[model samples]
Target: MPGIDRVTLTMITDNYVDMLLPDLPNVTRTGLAHHFDPKTECVQGENGIALHVDVRWGRYRYQALFDTGMSHQVLLHNMKVLGLEADEIDHIVLSHGHPDHYGGLEGLLRHRQAPTPVSAHPDAFAPRYLRLASGQVAPYFNYGLTKEAIRDSGGLLVEHTEPLEIGPGLIASGPIPRVEEFEKAPTDLSAPNALLHIRDGKIEPDIVPDDQALVIQVGDDGIVILAGCSHAGIINTIRYAKQITGRDRVVGVFGGFHLGFPGTPRSKTDKTIEALRELNVEVIAPSHCTGMESIMAIGEAFPDQFMLNVTGSKVTLQAGTQPVVDLDVEARQKIGLQ
Candidate 1:
């Protein structure tokens, strides 16, 4: 259980993008100045989440692309705008079976210079449908992310149900256990009318058993958790990460908290903030499906710790130091734009 010296997370695709956001401690934003060049393109926002993670431990380094966002067009475009090369990615980690999270996988695999390892749960490829509260099940939409599609696109699938290490100090959390009573799946997809999935030639309730997260241990600074939609409940995801890694102090938690969808009670948000406070998380960046109201509330609650994570945003966490925000000039220099 050794920790890494540092980890850098870049948002290749998200639901929002604001070039006006100023940098804060540990966070660097790709602002308007980055696109000053007439030929330089700006990143676009979509209804999905994709993160590029770079890890450094001693003399070794590892890179992982977590979730491919909603579309390859947006994902690749954003990556190009951020100066990230697809060939540099060493691994791909799918957080769940949702199309928004895996939509760009095929395209990304095709763009890679070599076959890439994709770590995910077996159930992620299952045919799934949304079950409405009126007892109606929506049509199944696989979004062309079948196992065959991944392989055909030069991706080597590495399916698992238990935590797997992607690199030094980086662990892909398997299916997280549901421990919080209040943090159940969305109301429309809850038991009795749960999300539908085909299994053994029969349609059954899908609790999204494939939902997972990425846990990074940053030296003694504690663990940083990166997630997709957190359909299993962010609190549950965090607790599970802690349980599996045996690390108590949570350095940061980023990604969709899954609290803004319809039917989610306001009390849930309150409880989530309370739970996070109890954990003393140093930084929290909720994005994508983490509804705006919930995001605002969390930011208000943890003004100093909250980070506005959007497309083109990069968060850097180094061992034995507080996260520092880089100004536009410094950010440009770091990206070699100066």
Candidate 2:
């Protein structure tokens, strides 16, 4: 794959940020509410992920949304703050069927009536859940986005169980193969500790067959990997990306690694850090469900390359270049409404 000029990833919606960066160079003490009209609800931080990926190389440019945050309100609100419209997105690729990742589909379609394609794993819509400390398994209320709802939004559902090339050098890992022994879902995550799915009129451990990630080949810079939630272990996800694309150099890995949870064991976190150190990726930006313990461990291991993906952060990556972080904003006056 030829090298791309640059890829800019903007965190449209995420759980946290040390500082609210509505526009770059001018950090704000308050959230977006300070810059935009009060009537227009300000963009909110949430326990979800919605990324705007803009890739540019030579004369070509491609745009995609990795995930739509749990709520349409936050997703849509953040888009407006970023000066982006739903219709402008070239395509949509979902990491899995989790509600927090796919719940905003209906709102996205309502905003952009265009029949843009949405690529996801075949089992993305299967039922899922989270187990409580009391040994009770609560069905994820939001669960998955329905096909009917997607159609209503003029979204073209493209379901696949295998890896696919979505853009010039972008490859979506259809279903990551689990090979790491230490990287497993927590026991309290469920009785069987597996995501549940309904198939053949029966519900069983889900095993999350649909869990995948997007791999971008940036020449010698190796690969830039993005995951919605690495239900399939992050190490496994990275290895699979390399296997499918025949690229061993992993430049960066971002998005949810499923590391941050009460059920997540310290041994596993340590092992993950050990594996990541061996892999020696250039940058590691973990966010959302990537538990604080794991984040701290990874941060300590890769201090120079570690970055926190908070809401309103813009991370830029290019081949043979160190990752750059900045406020995803320009001058407030420039984006101010008349």
Estimated TM-score for each candidate: 0.92, 0.86
Best by TM-score: 1
In candidate 2, which residue pairs get closer than 3 Å at backbone N, Cα or C atoms, i.e. clash?
23-329, 24-329, 195-206, 260-290, 260-291
In order, what lDDT does every prediction score?
Answer: 0.86, 0.76
The residue-by-residue lDDT of candidate 2 on 204-241, one tens digit each, is: 67667788898888866578899898989999998898
On lDDT, the leading prediction is 1
Please report the TM-score between candidate 1 and the true structure: 0.92
**Candidate 1 off by > 4 Å:** 132-136, 186-194, 321-338
| Candidate 1 clash pair list | 25-325, 26-323, 26-324, 26-325
